[model samples]
Target: MLTETRRVARIVLLDPDDRVLLLNGFEPRNPATTWWFTPGGGLEGEESREEAALRELAEETGITDVALGPVLWTRVCSFPFDGRRWDQDEWYFLARTTQTATDQRGLTELERRSVAGLRWWTSAELSATRETVYPTRLAELVRTLLDEGPPHVPLVLAPEIV
Candidate 1:
């Protein structure tokens, strides 16, 4: 089977307390398995990665006033969602905001069904959680970023096998 590569833009939105925002979602084909991931989605036509990241951030969450930083990381992920196999190249941007209020009104039908919850996670929480999280090394990465600051060039994360 030929699998098309999809470009995705994601944001690691940090709150004033350094907690990162994540969405909990599950594959429809296997609802029993769930995972937490940063907010993002496939890019629309002609949109730059940064533009798509900003758009997805506003659409997925409700805070739109945050200033986006540089692309902090990139990762390739392959997984099955719904009934289709997806091979995604994801770019992750960093943004900080104090706002926590979210409006789910903008979510698509698929998102409404697949995304069950959203939460802010401190590094400690992320490390201690038993729940599955994508980009598996999130806590360690975030801690490094927080201590050392964003890199001059985007970091290429190892591909994740789901």
Candidate 2:
């Protein structure tokens, strides 16, 4: 099968209470298979990573008043979704917002269909959940960010496939 390649900007959105926000969704072709992921999508036009991150966050999570923070991590991953193989280079940014509630008004048609819901997750909840969470080791990395702060150089995560 052919692969579609893209660079994506993702957000690790946190609330005042330090709860990370994640969206619960499933593969388009396989509804029973679900996962939680940060709000993000591929860059559009000539949008910079920061612009894409903010746009995607607003569109996917309905939180727009937040400022984009430094990138905390980056990764390259290959995976199949909706019957298409994708090679995505992704950057995860750290963003904090006082806005906790989420709305789906801005989702594209595909997003409206695939996204299930959004929720704030505590470190304990993220660490103990048996369900799949994208980018892997999110719990550990988040703890590091909260405890020590963003590293000078963004960490490059090991590539993953799922």
Candidate 3:
């Protein structure tokens, strides 16, 4: 028997002043409170992780010509969604963009409706905002990357459900 594979490639795009681009995402099928995360999505067909990252950035944020580099971090986890357990291996790459995104046409009506707001914020801002989840860690990561450049960190995975 063969098991299915689920791979997600995402980019953490940091601007010159050092603000990582994060998007508020939600599962429309089984609605939940919106949560903020880096902007990228799962790979489709035979698309490489790098290609998926670039494609997702352009599709979701209307930005192109991004310079993507090595994997910054990787996480393997599982989530319960749509009445099933979805195992996921998420890869994050170091990416940069000099231009500001203008058009957000890639979002669906429901996604647009669900997105409460959008703001480019610094690490301090991220820490201060009550709306941000995992505030402490997120702020620290942003600050680390901003100060010392990207760290090719690999998250350790324990064999257990998340």
Candidate 4:
């Protein structure tokens, strides 16, 4: 049977104040001022999703020793890459880090190249932020987590009429 080989796994990471971490950047291809996303990346060769999340956290934000959790959102991003529309299956997660990075740590090449900036935004602030890559549904989920506390409660989604 020919089937799509889609990757799957759990991803999660948190901030010092318990706020989720978000990344901001300008993809040369994308319009200017369109920046905002979580801190994470693809797994390295032979690396598990968990390992990749941990590694990406360090490489992108210099964050470490975090408590990882289940998948919050699995996004199928279809965008232009090298003049071709490439599909990216990204799995977002929920995690918590006891320690936070100080400004002294500074930005690394991965961060500088991939991310224009990083900021911790509360659920309320997220709505006001003119820029963010998070989907409205995902943002609402995050807001719920922040308001009610961790261990995201199950949310009932309204069924769409075909």
Q: What's the TM-score of each model vs. the native?
A: 0.96, 0.96, 0.78, 0.71
Off by over 4 Å in 1: none
User: How do the residues 4-109 of candidate 4 rate in per-residue lDDT, one tens digit apiece?
Assistant: 4334333445566657667666655553645576766655578887777767777666677778876655655544433344344566667888766624144555
* Candidate closer to the true structure by TM-score (higher is better), 2 or 3: 2
Model 4 poorest 10 in a row by lDDT: 153-162
For every candidate in turn, the CA RMSD to the true structure comes to: 1.0, 1.2, 3.4, 5.1
Candidate 2 per-residue lDDT, tens place, 1-162, comes to 566679999999989999999999898888998999999999999999999999999898789989678999999999887777789999999999999988889999988778999899998899999999987899999989989999899999999986
Candidate 3 collision pairs:
none
TM-score of 2: 0.96
> How much lDDT does each candidate structure score?
0.89, 0.91, 0.69, 0.59
| Candidate 1 residue-wise lDDT, 13-79, digit = tens | 9999999999999876678879999999998999999889888888888878787998999999998
Better by TM-score, candidate 4 or 3: 3
Index of the highest-lDDT prediction: 2
lDDT of 4: 0.59
Error of 1 at 66 (Å): 1.0
How many residue pairs clash in each candidate at the backbone level? Answer: 0, 0, 0, 6
